[model samples]
Target: MKTSECMLCPRQCGVDRSVKFGFCGESEEIRIARAAPHMWEEPPISGTKGSGTVFFSGCNLRCIYCQNHEIAVSHLGYAVTADKLLRIFFDLQAQGVHNINLVTAGHFAHQLIPILRQAKADGLRIPILWNSSGYESADTIRMLEGLIDIYLPDFKYINPKTAKEYSNAPDYPETAKASLAEMVRQVGAPQFDSQTGLMTRGVQVRHLVLPGHAQESRQILWYLFQTYGNGIGYSIMNQYTPMPQMKDHPLLSRKVTAQEYENVIRYAKQIGIENAYTQEGEAACESFIPKFSGQPQ
Candidate 1:
């Protein structure tokens, strides 16, 4: 399919992606950094087995301290056709994974629709999870309503200033809120498979606590708890390791302190957020980074 004026994300960089790259540095074709069984997800999603993860290349919001900068910013990956992606999904399913996780896949939503449809038709009976950066448009999210079984989105920042400083998107907070609301609307609450302890359908909001940004993480959790109540699951992340290039950037130059993470976890408990997942000490080890070894077929 030809890439028309690309407005898939809120960036709306109307570049002719058919012939050239857009602001996300991706065209109509789907480029993936990896496709493997990832065991690092939440307990319900990953379970004793793994989450079949497809790490898509490029991103709508290129955060300066992103852990996946190799794929998100540099766009270091191989392109794959929709049919090949379908095969990869089935292959992962055969590996005894609980679900198919699409990581950072917002930019390639249009291309994924067909693959998802075919996978469903072929009796690919695992939950399809859309893991995103949360800078999505409500309209774009609505388009994936039935196709997506779960929404794993980041409610990164409550302050626009922090968002713009880190991600170059001043409206990230507002847009992410609206987008998450739509996600919750589509997948109302967390439903698990009793036999396997796997998540079947739900909206899981993730917030990575940055160093010196504990208050911001608290504010984001407050907004989510107040808005969605106990209907949503939350992953309070403490795995904020400063990437190599962020050494000179003020707040991005260091890892989040134990005190910062403790404060956020304390606030989460105070707010009565029962269904939550948190990281322990030294969870930000580079060993957590998944290898981008999978290539297109």
Candidate 2:
């Protein structure tokens, strides 16, 4: 998390983040696209209230079919100082949120760690969730050990060909696996509050089912069950919206059919994956992707 030389993610694209931009297309300054109560998460994280979500701009991996393409690719967000970021957390905590969720923050880890530590010292009582793309370095994750209470990372792909084609990361399968193991080691196991139904500590691995990739999705499910064995919660997401930018692309042009989603879900049950989550009908629409301008801007 140093500004002098950037090695936050596995890419290790060394550049003075303060002067030159790295692979993530980010400078030293902290940029945030959204700060609000986001309810579009798991039941434990969102509960009756919502997860205090802070969506950081830019990303380590540039997934071609990303729903948050506006911020991930174009970096459509406003700049904020460390103090301002803390205020945002306070504001959300005042709104009775379940936890402080940091989304897509792998690129800005340098600027965020201190802010998170200060927030914790200043009575930021809610559990802190590290929501990431799962293309992370074990060193970077180990640095945030106790500071992060919940690890919500996406296990995107098992096939190197698919990873290279979509995310441009050929080592996604191994990288994500090691990252998940480290995350599970830190958090131990899933723990939830009885009355609040909020997740206090755990690792929740999310996988967005892509169109024409049901076989890979099933392999990812088996990998999770075999490796972690119910130590992490599996959330199978079928909410892949075909964004406008990928209209001409090959696989990203279409929506995931009900059969595709069902095929993956059915495989999870067959493989004895009981600790999991799945989406209902009509979740592959654009209504779920929030605007980049965000609220109360």
Candidate 3:
């Protein structure tokens, strides 16, 4: 949990973050690009109102097809103190959102642990979701044993070559597997509100099917279904929006085709993945991406 020689992520780029930047492209200080109620997540998480989402700047993975490359890569955000983040949590809770969703926040686990502890102590009662890239260190995830109520981590890749090519993380497959195991350990079972149907505690794994990676997506789905089964929830996403950065890349320059997405969905059905969520309509469009205005909406 030391930010001085930051090892909070699997990268282990031991640079003094206070004085230098790490592979995550962030300093010791926590930066937030956006804080608002998001209605685009899974139904249980977003509900009728929305999920109070805090988009943290900086990421452990460098995904070339990232839709939020503005904040994740460019780091165009203002710094916030622990007290400010604590207040943001309570303020979002006051907005009547179903839960507090922390997006891509595994890199800031050091600062978030204490801030989350204080938020709960100050009567922040909404379910807090740790929305991460799934390229996490198991030890770091263990530090958040009692604090987080829900986990929404992405299982981006199962092949090391694909992971390295897409996100520059070769160890992503093993790292994500271990991290997910730890998460399931922390949140034992999926719990839901009787009336609202909002998720109170559990883990939901998401996989975004890439343009030409339908086979790999099937592999990931098979792995998750085989390992966790109906013990956890699944989100087979088709919203792989091609960003401006991927214009030159042949494969990533285009959106996922309808047939490709349907094939993945068919495989999920074939594998008996009942407790899952799927996207409908034109999901591979930039319109679905949220705006990072650096101010809460």
Candidate 4:
């Protein structure tokens, strides 16, 4: 869990983070791009009040088609201490948010445990959600056992070859599998607040249906249904908007076709994954992406 020779993620880029930055382009400092309430998440997570979201800068597996490329590729956030982070949690709690959502905190999971504990001690209510890229170490997830109430992780790719070609992580599938198991073990079945319709505990697998890869998406749906059954939620995303930088790239140069999205959805029905969320028309747009430059208002 030491970032001095950072190994929190599967990358294990031992870079003595006290002196140098790791593969996540961050040192010991906690740099966050945005800290505010986000309503763009799934129904239960966003609810009516919206989830108190904090977007962290830098990422372990920055795919070629990353929607949050600005924050994922650069340091565009304010550096805050553990104490300050706890204060942010308290501030958001006062705003009457549905939950405290920690976006992409794996790189800083080493420092969050104590802060979360202290915040809860200081009367921080509401569920604690960990929104992740799913390329996490099981040990890292284990460290956050009771502290994290909900898990929102992406099951990006089922094939190692696709993972390697897209995100440069050949070990993504296996690594994510282990991480998911740990998360499920921590919170057994998916449980939601009956009155509020907010998720209290459970792991939700978010699989973005990539263009020209609907079959792979189908495969991932089948795997999730077979493995977790209806105990977990699956969000089939159609929000793969092609960024301007990818205008000349090989496969990421176009948006995910409507046919491709439908194909994936058809397969989901075949697998009986009724406990899933699917997108509708015109979801692959840049309007959904939040600005990651400074303090979000």
Q: For model 1, how big is the CA root-mean-square deviation?
A: 1.2
The candidate, 1 or 3, that scores higher on lDDT is 3
Q: Is candidate 3 or candidate 4 better by lDDT?
A: 3
Worst lDDT 10-window in candidate 2: 288-297
Q: Which 10 residues in a row give candidate 4 its minimum summed lDDT?
A: 288-297
Task: Report the lDDT tens digits of candidate 3 across residue range 17-75.
Answer: 98999998999888999999999999999999899999998888989888898898887
Off by over 4 Å in 4: none
For candidate 1, what is the total of clashing residue pairs? 0
Q: What TM-score against the true fold does each predicted structure earn?
A: 0.97, 0.97, 0.97, 0.97
Model 1 stretches astray by more than 4 angstroms: 294-297
Off by over 4 Å in 2: 294-296
RMSD of 2: 1.3
Best by lDDT: 3
Find the number of clashing residue pairs for candidate 3: 0
Q: Give the per-residue lDDT of model 1 (tens digit) for 19-74.
A: 87887889887899999988999999999889999999988898888898888878
Per-residue alpha-carbon lDDT of model 2 for 1-297, expressed as tens digits? Answer: 458778888888888987998888789898888898988899999988899999998888999888898889896888898889999999999999989999999888877888889999999999999999999998889889889999999999999999998989999889998888899999967899888778999899999998888999999998899988878888999999888888998877898899999999999999888889888867777888877783335
The best-first sequence of candidates by lDDT reads: 3, 1, 2, 4
Full-model lDDT, candidate 2: 0.89
